[model samples]
Target: MTLDDKKRVLREMVLHRRFEERCYQAYIERKIGGFLHLYPGQEACCNGVMEAARPGHDYVITGYRDHVHAIKCGTDPKVVMAELYGKETGCSKGRGGSMHVFDVAHRFMGGYALVGGPFPLAAGIAKGIQLKGGDEISICFLGDAANNQGVFHETLNMAKVWNLPVLFVCENNQYGIGTAIHRSTAVLDQYKRTCAYDIESAQCDGQDIDTVYEHAKTAVDFVRSGKGPYFLELMTYRYRGHSMSDSRGYRSREEEDEWKQRDPINILRDKLIAAGELSMADFTAIEKATDDYIENEVMKFAEESPEPNVADLEKYVLA
Candidate 1:
């Protein structure tokens, strides 16, 4: 990667990390509500891939654990905080909460909370693009546990049969809720699941931004060229628990520390420093700027936003 690209990734990853840490603080202060999922250690998965995607053309849809995706897709951080606070000024007008951050303008489809739900939705979106004769693509991100769901299989089957323009990205963080992938699945080769539908698949070290971008770019290009769907298994790990409520009883501090040593953001920063592409001063400046951005956004979301009125409770109801 060029020095410029490396710097860009560093900035985005740092911003993502700080933004998530601030969210945790907001939850503690009771400034935000709902299931607060932190994307602390998985920044590279979202940052690098979003960089590779052709923004404004390709669509991104994903299951929960989506705050990173929202930020990476260019949604104003303040609005996202407002959404978590259930304020009227939020991106979903204070209705969607933490699990359903949708930004139509940026082509970020609904951040569905249902396990494996976005897989088919992504395929359907790609089908729409194909039917309309547009060269757009959809990238569906899901957890490793989601790969076992029926929707995953069904979506892959349909996508392969129809030759839809979509990329199935499985961010295998090794565990789903409290169950690790090794315990949950007989075969741990998550990428091989795509072969059942005869789709192209590749696995990459999700902790490395450059590796992810290189592989995802190739997979995305294949789908964009009308060659049908492709799949990428990003072997990543999350530092935080499955949700804010986790008691940390399921895993040990030692295991967590081991993964922390391989932290993606720190790894990328070290690489830049070792290559003499960035200095400690530059990184410190970036960190301060990102910290200020998150803090300012939190205050902005809290001060200027209003909660939803009671009358609207049954207003958007479809029945």
Candidate 2:
């Protein structure tokens, strides 16, 4: 990444980290409701991929833990918060909540909740692009656990057989719900699993923003070249529980702390600061700006976006 790009990625990673931090704080304060999943540790997977692709042209669909992707995809933070609050001005008009943020403008299909649901949906999106003679690419983001499902192999077989333009991103965060990857899979090389379909694949240090961008760029380009789907297994970890009410008895605090040491935001921040790309004052200013922006959005959503009139219920529903 260039110096300018590095600075931008650092700012983006911080925004995601802080945005998620604030979301968790809101959940604690009861200002935000519902099952809020924080993306504090997986910032690179969302932000790095966003930085690599054109938001309007490329499509990205993922499982729940979606707020970071919404932010990265240009959805207003206030609307996301409003959705969590079940307010009308939300991205899904207060219906989808935290799990289904769909933004057509950015080509973010949705935040599906079913473990491996988005796999085939993303394939369909890529097929649509191919039919329309467009160069757009679709990316399906799923956890390592989803890789075990029959849908994963089915999607891979069909996509490669048809030469669909898509990227299957496996965020092998080392855990799925509560089970470790090693305990779940006999074959731990998640990238090598792509060989079953003869697709190109690579593994990256998902904790490093630059490494992610570079590797994703290569994989995405390969897929876009009509070479078929590319798979990337990003070795990452989540700093928070799976959801709002997770007991978290499955992992150790020491494990979380060790991953925190390798936090993508911190790594990018340190690099930018050490390389004279950014200063502490600049970093602080960026943080303050992002916080203020989010606060302003929240207030705007609260004050300006009206609630859905009860009389209008069933209006959009099919008979």
lDDT of each: 0.85, 0.83
Worst 10 residues of 2 by lDDT: 294-303
Q: Model 2, range 11-113, lDDT digits (tens) per residue?
A: 7777777778877887898877778877878888877766777776789899998877877778777777777776778888877888888787877788999
Pairs that clash in candidate 1: none
Model 2 stretches astray by more than 4 angstroms: 299-304
Give the 10-residue window scoring lowest on summed lDDT in candidate 1.
294-303
After superposition of all CA atoms, the RMSD between model 1 and the true structure is 1.5
- For model 1, what is the alpha-carbon lDDT of residue 284? 96
Per-residue lDDT over 1-319 for candidate 1, one digit per residue giving the tens place of the 0 to 100 score: 5789889879988987887888788789887787977888788887767778876567999987887787777787788878888888888888898889988898889799888888889999999998999878888988899998998899999999999999888898888888878888977989988888899999998998989989988998898889999999998888988988986677888988988888898889999999998888989999998888776766675557788897888766696
Predicted structure 2: lDDT: 0.83
